[model samples]
Target: MSVILESKSSRVCINEKGAEVCSFVLKETNLEYIWQADETYWARHAPVLFPFVGKLKGDSYTYNNESYTMNQHGFARDMVFIVEHQEKDSATFLLKSSEETLKNYPFHFELRLIYRLVDNDLTIAYQVETQSEEMYFGIGGHPAFNIPLVKGTNFNDYYLHFAPSKSRFLLPLEGAFINLAEKTLAQTNTSIQVERRIFEKDALVLETKGENAFSILSDVTNHGVVVSYDNLPYVGIWSPFPKEAPFVCIEPWAGIADTTDATGKIEDKKGMNLIHPGDVFERSYKISIK
Candidate 1:
């Protein structure tokens, strides 16, 4: 099932499954910003990564001396979420830990995805609460926007503008795991062109030193998107490998994949967030249509 939220300038559609945003369209030009799932390239629209982000060592992790297996990006994106609250321009979907989730993520917790649409912007907030003495997890956003945004423009015409011009470093992935060898992605440049070759090595996992924000802009048209996050340490830019897909994903992650020599323990996983009982963990990112 899906819920529709409308503002004066835009309309957004979100599905109960995955609490994913299926569409974001501007009323003025009627242009769709959110990528429409195309199986020929990629099948998901916007999937929320939770409990873990990216790939894990051996696709499994050990917690409390027992082993539990999970696939890439964890299981939240494939699970159905209950609509806990709704309004004209906002909605909250809730997912609670159950027997099935506990089998792989042995913890009692509640995950809430709250989406609010205002004017030409959409803000997504992730909230996690644990009933157990302690809980370890990661959460992130994978919202792909349609490239070329305008009909006459080509994908190559768009570029990503990173804020606060300075040198940026990327943690390159070694076979789906972090290699830990930081490489300079950009030097004193505020923008990078959109191209298929950039993603040939998988997602560009970056560490931005200042305000975490970026914008997709095109030389031919004024239509684009600006994505800004609050307190997310890492940002990822990706598109399907070697596919020349019609969209690009801007991701904000609280945790990253395991290092190549990781010990396979959930607690030991790099970048994972931990929360104790009676505490709530919250993070949010915003998408503003241009």
Candidate 2:
């Protein structure tokens, strides 16, 4: 099932399966900013990553000395979410822990995704609450936008412009695991031209010390998107590997993939967030059409 939200300038469609944003269209120019899931390259629009981000060390982790298995990016994205509330330009979807989720995640929790549209910007907020003594998890946003943005431009014509920052580093991946040896992606410089080879190794998981914003811009056209986040510690830029897909994903991550030498313990996982009993965790990011 899907829900629609509209503003004076834009129309957005969200699927209930993942609470994923399937389409974001600017009304003025009839331009669709979100990627249409074309399976030849990638078949997802904007998927919500929860309980885990990226890949596990061995696609399994131990909790209390008992081994449990989970796939890359966790199970939330494939689960059905109930429409909890809705208004003209905003809606909330809720996912409560189920028997199916507990077999792997082992938690009694509720996850909520709240989306709001204001003018040309779409804000997505994530909330998690758990009843267990403590919950360890990761969460993130994987939103892929059309690269060309405008009809006349090509994928290579677009580049990513970062907000001014002191330094930025990328945690390079060895296959699906993180390589602790960080590489300097930029130093005061703020722009990287889009290219196919940059993602040859996979998503560039970035850590920027001072800024949490970036944009997709093209030299040939004025159409683009600005992505900004709050409380997200990592940012990932990715596209389908070796496929030259027509979309680019700007991800905001609260956690990251397991390290190559990960201990196989969920509690010891790098970048995992913990919430104490009766507490709630929240994070958010925004996409603005320009």
Candidate 3:
């Protein structure tokens, strides 16, 4: 069933059949910024893309001498999950590993998404609990926020501003993890071009310095949301969106983009998290409008 829960401070919407947002829109400000995409597909709030998910070599990969076929993004973001529980400003949703998924992923696990609203920020927390010792995989969020921006505005007027601009950033090659191609401070407050292909070369990796905090802003004003990843290694600015929509995504990833160097084995994938059997791992990100 479709569920929309609201608290005095936030709102959590779960498509149950698709992905359940722990907290997307907050009761704080003008952030009712969910996309109008039909619930039948992806609903614009950070999508949880994961697990040997994401486009792989020829849309195929090898594991233990066997090849597996799966979509680029994981199935969690693509299925109707069960509403495990909820209360006020928080909610928990789950999806079980399936026989169908076992064909490609080959693991038993429970995925949970918990959202909470605190102060002026809306936090999306992702948790993965492993039920098998087989292998663990990659996970990330693809939340597209409305630019609150206008059309005709060239990406040249936009600058990625970090509260702690002195912090280091990562270098991700087209389809790879957040490793240092080079490390440097984000001192640039100028326009940069926009293109979907940029992602093709590799994600513009950041040097979070264990502090996943940053923002994508327009030269127009001080208007933008401050993104705080729970020490996430990746935070990206992407609008390469068609002119029809003034939307951009500030992605917080525990994982990184896949690369030509990818070893094909999910366990061999760079930045792949290894959760001990029965261990539950959790990560989160917060977005506060300034």
Candidate 4:
């Protein structure tokens, strides 16, 4: 089922399949800023990443003394979410651990996704509560916005503008996990041009020791999206087959992929957030389209 929300200026569709956004349209311009999930390039629109952000080293992890294999981004995105609340401009979907999930994650928890639309801004909030012992997990957002937001515009015409112009480190992936070495990213101060060659290596995972927000702006269109991540330590920018794909993803993550130096223990993976029994983990990111 698809839940719809509307504001005076825009509207969006959220599918229950993964609690993912399928479409976002600006009412005035009739413009679609969110990707349409064209299978030729990429098939997902905006997927919520939970428990794990990226790939686990060796596609497995050890918890306590048992080894479990989990696919990239965990299983939350593949499960159906129940609608807990709905209003004209907001909706909340929820997913709780079950026997099926415990088989792999072994944690009892509830994950809530609340999406609220106000004017041209959309706020997506995540809440995770633990019902068992300490739980180690990660959560994130993978929202792909359409490039060349305006017709006749070129992808290179757009760029990511970072405020305060600070130098940051990029952690490149070797075999799907972080490399031991760090590379300089956006060293030119601010505004990194969006080009295909930039992603020839892979997604640029900005080390989150500094700045936590960024804006996607186009010199030609003079309009774009601003993403503000509250308390998220990692941000990822990616586009599949950058040359052919027509979308770019701005991701905010509370966790990260297993590092090259990981020991495969779930408790020791870098960037994992821990929640004690009866405790709740809350985080959010906002997308403002201009």
Highest lDDT model number: 1
In model 2, what is the error at residue 287, expressed in angstroms?
0.4
Mind giving the per-residue lDDT tens digits that candidate 4 earns over 62-151?
Answer: 998999889999998899999999999999999999999998898899999999999998999999999888899999999999998999
TM-score of 1: 0.97
Q: What lDDT tens digits, residue by residue, belong to model 3 across residues 26-127?
A: 455645544545344334556777674345656666767888877766677777778788766566778888987788777888888776665556677878
Deviation of model 4 at 132, angstroms: 1.2
Candidate 1: regions farther than 4 A off: 183-185
> In model 2, which regions exceed 4 Å deviation?
183-188, 209-211
**TM-score (all chains, Cα) for each model:** 0.97, 0.97, 0.79, 0.96
Candidate 1, 1-290: lDDT as tens digits: 89999999999999999999999999989999999999999999999998999999889999899999999999999999999999999999999999999989999999999999999999999999999989999999999999979888999999998776666778898879988865556542668889999899899898765467788998889899999975888888999989989999999899998889899999899899999998999989999997
Candidate lDDT values, in order: 0.91, 0.90, 0.62, 0.87
Local distance difference test, candidate 3 = 0.62
10 residues in a row with least lDDT, candidate 3 = 173-182
Give me the runs in candidate 3 sitting further than 4 Å from their true place.
9-12, 20-31, 38-43, 52-54, 149-159, 167-203, 217-223, 241-244
Q: What is the lDDT of residue 284 in candidate 3?
A: 78
Q: Given candidate 1, what's the lDDT at residue 84?
A: 100
lDDT comparison, 1 vs 2, better candidate: 1
